[model samples]
Target: MSKALDHDPDHWPRRLVAVTPVLPMLPILIVCALVLVGLVDGSGVTWVPLLATAPALAATTGGPRGVLCVGLLSAVLGVSLGIRGDAADGVLAVALASLLVVTLACAATSALRGRRERVLAAVRSVAEAAQQALLQPIPATVGPFQVAVRYSAAAAEARIGGDLYALVSTPHGVRLIVGDVRGKGLPAVGTAALVLGVFREAAHDEPDLLDVVARIERSLARNLGTDDFVTAVVAGYPRDGQLEVVNCGHAPPLLVRDSVVVPVEPVRPAPPLGLRTLSGETPDLQVLPFADGDQLLLYTDGVTEARNHDREFYPLAEGLARHTGDEPVDTVTALHGELLAHVGGRLHDDAALLLLRMPARTEAPAPREPSGTVRVESCSP
Candidate 1:
C-alpha cells in the first residue's frame, strides 16, 4: 500500500483538497431550494426569481464546459418558472441574459488557469534538466570497490544542491571527496561546482593526497568569499589493504572493518575549505587499513545533524552497524531509507551518503602483520 501511494506522486489528501462538487449539480440543488422557498411562501413576489443564482454558482465551481451546461439549465429552468409563476416575458429574458454574461466570464477564467499550468510545467522540466546535468549519475563499480551514492535535496522543486561527492581512479589510487557548502540555493550550488571541478582535476594530477587537498583549497580561496566555505572529507585507496583520508572540518568518515564501524576523526581538525585563515591549520591526513571485506562510508554534516521532532540526533554509527554489510550498494540503500524514516520523510537540509566496499582478492592476500594501527568502533557518539 505504501509503495503504491509513493509511486503515485499525488496522494489522496492532496486530491481531496483540490476537489470540487460537480458544477452542473450545484445548479440542480439551487433550483430545488428556490422551488421549496416558493412553495412555502406563495406571494406576488415569486421565489422563482431566485433561479438566477444557478448560473453564477455554476460559473464559480466549473470550467468552460460546466459553465455552458449550467447556463443552459438555468435558462430552461428560468423560462419554466416564469410560466409556472404567471410572470412577464421581460423578467425571464433579463435573468437569462445576466447568467450568460457570468458564464462567459467564468469560461475565460478557466482558460487563463490552463495556460498558467502549462507554463509552470515547462519551467519544472527545465529545472530538472539542469539538475541532472549538475549531478551526473555515478556507476555501480569504480576500480577495485563497489560504490553507491544517495543524495536528497532539501528544495524539492530545484532538485539540485551543494552536497557534493566524486570518485576517480587515479595513478595514486581511487580518490573520493564528499562535501557540503555553507549556505543553500543557487549560491550553494555555485560553490559545489567549484569544489567538484577542482577536486576532479586535482585527483588525477596530484600524486600526494595533501597536494590534492591543497589544489582544492587554492581554487576555493580564489573563487569564494570569506563567508563561503565547504566542509569535506577526501579519501583514497592508494593500494590494497590501505586507505588514506583527509578531513576538512567535516563529519568524520565511518570505517567498517572486520564487522565493526568506527568514525575516523582527524587528529587535528582544520577549518573548512575557504576559511583556513581563521583556523591557521591544514587538514590532517589519516591512513587506515582497507583490507578485503572492509568498507568506508563518507558523508556530509547533513547526515549526522538530521534530527527528529523530539530534537534527537540520528545515531549514524548505530544505523551504519545495523544496516551495513559486504555490498556497498545494498548497505547505502538501506541506510538512506532508514535515514528518511528517522527524519519523518523529508530532511530539512540536504543529505548525502557514499559507501565503498573493497572486494576480496582472487588468491586471498596472505595474512601479514598489520603495518598501522586501525581504530575499531561499534558505539554511538
Candidate 2:
C-alpha cells in the first residue's frame, strides 16, 4: 500500500501512467481538429476562442518552455485561419488576447508543480535511508534456522512505524525480539529504535536471555514516560534441542510441530517493559522443545487485532496451517498476502510477522557446546 514515487516508467503509479503521456500531445491534437472544423463550417472566430484550451491542458504535464511552445503554435494557427475565413479584426484580437492570458497563467502553474515533485523525491530518498538503518536487513538463514520477515506500516507513505523486529547470530546463539510500542508516530518509532539498540548489544554481551531483556527494560524505564511501554517477546536458541522465551504482555507465539499449530502461552505472565516497577514482577523464562522440522511464529498485536468488513479478527493459526511449507519465505509470503486481503487491501495499524523454522536434519549436526547454563523456571509443550 506504500506509494513512493518511482523513477522507472513501468513501475509508476496507475494514476500517473494513465494521465501523463497523453496530456502533452493533447494541445497539438486539439489544434488540428479545430483546423478541420473551420474548413468545414467556413467560420473561424467561434472555434478560435476554444484554442485557449490547448495551453491550459499542456500546463498540467509539461514545463514552462513546453507551454510557451504550444501557446505560440495555437496563436499561429489562429491567425492563418482568421485570414482565410475573413473574420472581423476585433473578434480576432479578443481571441488572441484570451489565449495569451491563459498561456501565461498555465506556465506559472507548471513551474510550481515541477518544484514540488523534486522536493518530494528528495524526502523519499531520506526516508528510505533511515529505514535501512533502523531495521537492518536479515539474511535468509541464521545459525541453525531459516528466517523470514514481513512488515507493514499504517502510514504507507512513511514506510516505517512502531512495530519492530530483529534477529542476530550472537556468541550465545540465534537471538531475536519482536515488539510493539505503546503509541504511534515519531515517539513510538524512537522507542522501537531504543529497544533494538539495547537488544542487539545485550544479546552479544549477556549469555542469559533474561539479561538481554532486562537491559532493554532498564533502558526503557529510564527513558520512557510513565504512561508509555512496549510489549515484546524475546527468544533464543542456545543449544541443539531447547528454545528459551520471555513473554512480556505480548501475543503468544505460534508453534508448528508435525503440521499442528499451537500457541505458546507464558506460564507466568509479566508486565510489559517500562511498567515492571508498577507490577514488581519479573518475567519467567519458558523453555520449549524445539526439535527438527518445527517452526515458530512471532507477531505484533496488529496482526491479530485487524478486523474485516464482517468485524471478525483474522484467524492467524488457521492461515498459518494452510500456508505452512518447507520454505520459510514461501510460508511467510502466503500469510502476508492473506493478511492484506483480510483487511481490504490496507491495514489500519502497523503489522509485523517473523517466522523461524528449524529444517529437518538429513544427518546429525555436531553438538554445539552451550555457552552458559539456561535457567529454565518453567516448561511448555
Which structure among the candidates has the greatest lDDT?
2
Using Cα atoms with residue i matched to residue i, what is each candidate's TM-score against the true structure? 0.76, 0.86
lDDT of 1: 0.73
Q: Rate the local accuracy (lDDT) of all candidates.
A: 0.73, 0.83
Error (Å) of candidate 2 at residue 56 is 3.0
Please give, for residues 121-207, the per-residue lDDT of candidate 2 as tens digits: 898688677677778777777899877777767765666789888999998999999999999998999999999999999999999
**Superposition error at 81 for model 1 (Å):** 7.1
Superposed model 1: Cα runs more than 4 Å off: 1-106, 362-381
RMSD (Å) of each candidate, 1 decimal: 8.4, 7.8
For model 1 the local lDDT of residue 261 reads: 88
Clashing pairs in 2: none
Kindly report which residue stretches of model 2 are placed more than 4 angstroms away from their true locations once superposed.
1-20, 363-381
